[model samples]
Target: MNTIQDISKFSSQEKTFVTIGTFDGVHFGHQKIIEKLVSDAKNANKKSVLLTFFPHPRMVLQKDSNIELINTIEEKKSLLQKTGLDYLIIHPFSKEFSRMTALEFVRDLLVNQLNISKLIIGYDHHFGKNREGNIVQLTEYSHLYDFVVEEIPAQDIDDVSVSSTKIRRALLSGNLKTANNYLGYHFMLNGNVVNGKQLGGKIGYPTANIDVKEDYKLIPKTGVYVVKSNIDGLETFGMMNIGNRPTVDGNHQTIEVHFFDFNQDLYGKNLTIELLYFLRDEQKFDSISALIHQIKKDEKTARDYIKNNL
Candidate 1:
């Protein structure tokens, strides 16, 4: 799929079938809409276009700095690419763009700029200047613009029984199974391995400290999780800890993964860890020896789970 960062760069003369949304997680519900967009466009011999916004409209318009997203912009693009879309347009969301009136958005952008022939949208979707444009307004404007508006009814959308909000909630609450069920894939954490204090090494459980650069990415609840990663084309299992080391009097939270039966220098390597199961909540042990004993048990449990499941 061709990805266009700017809408103006889309100079295709072919009329397009378009759908617009943040499409945050690209969960099952969003997939249903995308499937229809691709299939219908193919059947009609038109180009399928997905117009999404960056920085999230809420982040700009509502000044919501604390809002966590299920997928980063790059992750969303990677997921959407698998849906067979002809074009994916990621428009920047800003205060000025949010001020555009509903009429200007439809007439100036959709009709004149995009050359959109048909718009496939959710049933309750609203947009443009305080979200004044609804399905009713879209239908009215389609007549003036000489295009079509197809609103996927609420029942059709709810058939998937999933939403970005639900996925976020599941992850935040350590309900990985429910979140993965809705996502149709395991939740992942991508980051670069960084040097640590060597505390784990002293305890005979060295770990690779990961630094996730995206501030808005939603991290799962603080706990020990069974995770897997591909190291040089080999699938490796690991146990990950996501919490402050209260026993060691550590102050800040850290994400550290100790790969099972694998030893290599990973200080500068990038890794993607996929969470498979929630092992247990992090706790402070009374002594270093106590913590080491628990770590041994956690390792065995993680290994057994991976062996049985995989």
Candidate 2:
């Protein structure tokens, strides 16, 4: 798919079938909308365009510094790329942009700028200037602009019992299975491997300490999880821990992964770990030896699960 950062750069003369949303996780519900967008565009001989906004509207409007997103911008783009969209337009979201009136958004942006022949939107979607625009306004604009507006009814769009919010809540509660099922894929954490205190090595379970750069990206609940990653083009299974090392008197949270039967210098390298299963909640063991013993058990459980299910 061709990704355009600036809407003005999209100079395509071909009329487009457009849909707009944050499409945060691109979960099953969002996938249904995308599928219809692509299929409808193809059937109608128009370019499929997905218009998404960056710095999420809430982040800008509410100054919500604590907002955590399920997917980073790059991750969202990567997920949407698999949906057979022709064009992905990522527009910057700002207070000024949000101030545009509903009619200005439809006439200036959608009709004049995008050359949108048809708009496919969710049933309850609202936009423009405090969200004054709704399906009813969109239908009115369609008549004035001589364009078509297809509303994916609430029942159609919500048939799947999945949403980004639900997935986020599930992950925050250590419900990896429910989150993954809703996402239709494993939840991934991408980061660069960094040096740790070498405490795991002393316990015979060396780990790669990961540093996630995106502060807005949500990290799952504190626990040990079964995860997988690619190292030197080989799929590697591992158990990951996300918590403070209470046994070692460590106070800060850390994300560390110990690959089973594999050892390599990964510091300074990037790793994308996909969470497969929730092994157990992180515990404050009585002693270092006890913690090590539990880790061994976690490793065996991860190995068995990977063997049978992977």
Candidate 3:
């Protein structure tokens, strides 16, 4: 896949089939639209292009406050590239860009810059200043621009719209099962392993500590989870925790994973963790023995869940 970060480097073509969206998670619903883009482009003998924005529109509009993301830029690119699209156009969203009218946006960016032949969008997808462009405006422009327009219906399962918001909510609530189903894969977190106080080691469950560097990335509620950790190319089953070590009076919340039946030094390395199940809520144990007993049970549950399902 070719990534076009600047509009100047777009290299206008005779025709291209394109869709535009932020596509945060690139969830199953987004995949359906992308699959259509691919098929439509192939059928029309044109390049398949995805026009997405960086920093998310909300971040630019809201400035200081914005909800965290489901995937980072690197993660989004990786996922989108796997769908076999021809081109990925990343527009740097800004205040000036946000001010463009629907017609100006279509004429200058979509038509004039990229030379889109057929535009595909979701049923409720809107664009331009203040979301002024809707399907009606697109239809009107189709006649003038001499391009075709296709609207993909909103995807839903059992009347529930499959959306990024819903998936994020599920993840935040520690409902990994529902989140995974919507995402069409495991809910994953990528981070760098960092040094910790070795509290887990003292309790016989050594953990690999990870710290994520992201301004707007969602962190799940404090709990024990059945997780699969990827170190280099090796995959290991583990139980991960996202919370403060309450028993030891540790105040900072951290992400730590203890691999099942495995011991290895993973400090300073990057790792990806996939959450499979939510075991129990975080608690403050009365004593060290009580904490250890609860951890043992959590480990057993994680092990059993992974063995049976993962």
Candidate 4:
């Protein structure tokens, strides 16, 4: 997939089939929409273009909403890349861009700029100034613009029974299995490895500190989790701790990962850790030895799960 950062800078002579949304998690429901879009575009001999936005509409319109996204913008792009899309246009979303009326957005951007021959949108999709546009408006515009508008019906969407919001809630509540099932894949954290206080090293469980740069990216419920990562093309299983060092009277939450049977320098490498299972909630142990003992038990549990399920 060719990713274009700014939609304004994109100009194509070939006609295109398009879909527009935030596409936050790129979950199974979203995947079905993209699959249809790509398939339809190919059947019509037109290019498939997914017009998603950065900063998300909520982040721009609802500043006090305190919205935490399931996937960062980069993560969303990576997930969409597997769908065989022709183009992924990540337009900058702002108050000014949101002010474009429904007709203007359709005629100017979709009809003229994107050269959209067909447009696919999910049910209840809204656009334009104050989100006044709806499926009815889109159909009307399509007739005037001489294009086709397809709305994935309410029944179709409801059948999937999954949404980004629900998935976020599931993760926040420590329901990893339900969240992953809804997502049709493992929920992941994308971050760079950084140096830590070396507390894990002292406990005989050296860890790599993960620095997730996206502030809006959602972190799962604080606990110990079984995780896996592909490091330099090798699958590595590990246990991750997401909590403060309560035993040591530490105050801030940290994400530290310790891989099993693998030792290599990862101080500065970017990594994507996929959460496989939740072991237990983080708690304050009586002493460092107690903490270390619990960690050993967690490691055994993780290895057993990895052995049987993975």
Q: Pick the candidate with the highest TM-score.
A: 3
**Whole-model lDDT values for every prediction:** 0.89, 0.90, 0.89, 0.91
Against the true structure, candidate 1 has what lDDT? 0.89
Badly placed stretches (over 4 Å) of model 4 are 154-160
Better of 2 and 3 by TM-score: 3
- TM-scores of all candidate predictions against the true structure: 0.94, 0.96, 0.97, 0.96
Give a tens-digit lDDT track for model 2, residues 14-73.
Answer: 899999988888887788888999999999898999999998998898885688899999
lDDT of 1 by residue, 1-310 (tens): 9999978788668899999999888877788889999999999999999999998988887675688888889889889999999999999899999999899999887988789999999758899999999989999999999999998864223354577888899899989888877877788888999999989988889999999889888989999999999999999999999988888876998999999988899999999899999998889999999999999999999999998998
Sequence-dependent TM-score of model 4 = 0.96
Clashing pairs in 2: none
1 or 4, which is superior by TM-score? 4
Q: After superposing candidate 2 on the true structure, give the runs of residues whose Cα lies further than 4 Å from its correct spot.
A: 154-160
Each candidate: RMSD: 2.0, 1.7, 1.2, 1.6
Which tens-of-lDDT digit does each residue in 181-270 have in candidate 3? 888888788999899989889889999998988868788888899989766678888999999888887688899999988877889988
Among these predicted structures, which one has the highest lDDT?
4
Per-residue error (Å), model 2, residue 222: 0.4
Using lDDT as the measure, name the better of candidate 2 and candidate 4.
4
Please write out the lDDT profile of model 4 over residues 1-310, one tens digit for every residue: 9999998888999999999998888987788889899999999888999999989999999999989999998788889998999999999999999899988999899998999899999878999999999999999999998999888753233455778888999999999998898888999998999999988888899999999998899999999999999999999999999988788867888999999998898999999999999999988988888888999999999999999999
